[model samples]
Target chain A: MSVNTTQKKHKFNVIDAVILVVICAVVAAAAFLLGSRNAQSEQNSVTLEYIVEFRTIRDEFVDNINVGVKLVDASKKYSLGDVVAVTSKTATFIGTDFTSGQLVYGDYPDHSDVQITVRSNAVINDSGRYVIDGGYEMSVGATVYARMPDYTGTGYCTQIKEIKD
Target chain B: MSEKNSAAKASGKKLRLNIIDFLIIVVILGAVAGIALRFGVVEKVVTKSSLSSAYVSFLIQDIQDESANYFVAGDSFYSQTHSAEFGVLQSNIQFLPAEAYINNEVGELLKVYKEDRIDVRGVFLCEGIFTDEGFLLNGTSYIAPGSTVHVLSSTIDVTLTVTEIDAVGAES
Candidate 1:
């Protein structure tokens, strides 16, 4: 009777070990599938392109200012009237600064791309507006170009390159 | 009496189960589910705001392009404002002094796109002289009707109407 009882106990132990192994395998497979799915999601990211035309925004003549720095600054600066053409497949215009959709640069050639750099202000007010402006002097008739590349996931404006033929 | 006593004694053998063990398992499961909900999935769908903005921006661009075509089909200033000196900068639709409002409208259009995180649409210019004799003869210039001569900025969009033609500078 003692031998018989010992044999029964051993059989039960074998079954328990098998069950434990099965459970471990199931858990590990679940984890691996979840991990691979996550990596796939990362690979399937989407990007949207926006064509911004920076035209002349406002024209002002600096009489007393030095020409070298100020003129160079103007080349890098872009405003509302700048014309930007995006070669991307599609574009959407959310909103703009002017009521009329025409961007004005002094007199840039039609095909030149407008370059714009955005600087963020640290102050926050009751009005939730993200005010960005440029720090450069613009000639009366110099034209500028602009295009905005905004990400679909992150609410951020990406860099804009000048459209050169 | 001996059989009855043995049966009673066998029935008295202790068998114990702890409630804490079951509770602990439940708590672990609840925690794992919460984590899955928060970070494991379902957060990748595009938000409504983004989708709407994309549609709106595209719509505005189309409208502006249509308006330019309409202007082109008339006895407008754009028909006469021709010359290489005017530069390609102002060559999209034709520009008449009166059409300056259309040019200015782009600024406001950008503001609308701004809410949706899109960039400003292209700038359409009316190619014409600020003066009748072309900015050199007399200060007064006449723009052909239905031209893109107006200029606008994003700052002014907050208080201005997109179609209003009042902000444009008169022909020089």
Candidate 2:
């Protein structure tokens, strides 16, 4: 019988340790990049105040909106923002006069043109549209439907401004 | 001398090249890759969103005037199929004579009201996201002009067609 003395490479040797180090380095690099990206996103977030104009809304609905009321999208339940201010004016409707074909403006009875100022945290997207809650587009002319605790209405975003960091 | 040279070269290799070492290295690399992936991007998924609601008008036809009384302001209803809270009746129902089409002598259609069949238009506040395609109710049900809906409320159950879709506070 012959004695076998060849060693198997099952032990943790230098190359194995080096490979482990490389693996740790790779994971550390990935973790660093991920943390940097999250920090960048967090830094890019800011509080912005925007004005949404709800036109031809019932005056009764206007009564339900007040300062400090939280607004949300009634469907799918998106938290829009809080009502910071409420202003309104008598609503006017434009119509065509059939006989002379003239344009006319008439009062919308019991209706009011309402403007609501809402403050929300948003991030500046690469396209420059302020994204509220990461998805709601705060661009002007985008139609928005905001719902309060007691009422809901459709409106257009007329203006947006950065209030603070 | 050639055999001695080969032996020296083999001893010079720091780590012996073997299939087992290759597989072990591959497994370690794969585990590292998995760890890298696990720490990346999964936390970035957005879990936040808000609800969207719209004001819609549905037309209920061929119903008695008494059924019109069921859709009063502030009354809530449900979808007949899903049994989910569909919407609340916002305004009182509007009445019109249900129109029927009859061909005349020259094949032109004539419009006439059907006897005893009245049509009503009622506005409802529905929860939905408005897209370019149309309004999506509760993220599943789609509502638009001409879409038929079956609705059941505490006071009434009826089938209706969407006649108009408007957003709350929609401007002219």
Best candidate, DockQ-wise?
1
Q: By DockQ thresholds, what CAPRI class is model 1? A: incorrect
Q: Give me the chain B TM-score of candidate 2.
A: 0.64
What TM-score, over all chains together, does every model reach? 0.19, 0.47
Tens-digit lDDT string for candidate 2 (A1-165): 332335654676788788767766777897897886577569778788888898976565566557787766645446678889989997776655665666666666667898999998887877877877646767789787665544455788899898755
Using Cα atoms, each model's DockQ against the true complex is 0.09, 0.02
What lDDT score is found at residue A13 in candidate 1? 61
- In candidate 1, stretches whose alpha carbon ends up further than 4 angstroms from where it belongs are A1-18, A30-165, B1-13, B16-172
- What local lDDT score does residue A58 receive in model 2, on the 0 to 100 scale? 54
TM-score of model 1 relative to the true fold? 0.19
Give the per-residue lDDT of model 1 (tens digit) for A1-165. 121112122233665566566656666887897776456435432221222223222111111111111111112322222212222211222334365554543322111222233222211112422212222222223332221211010012344222222
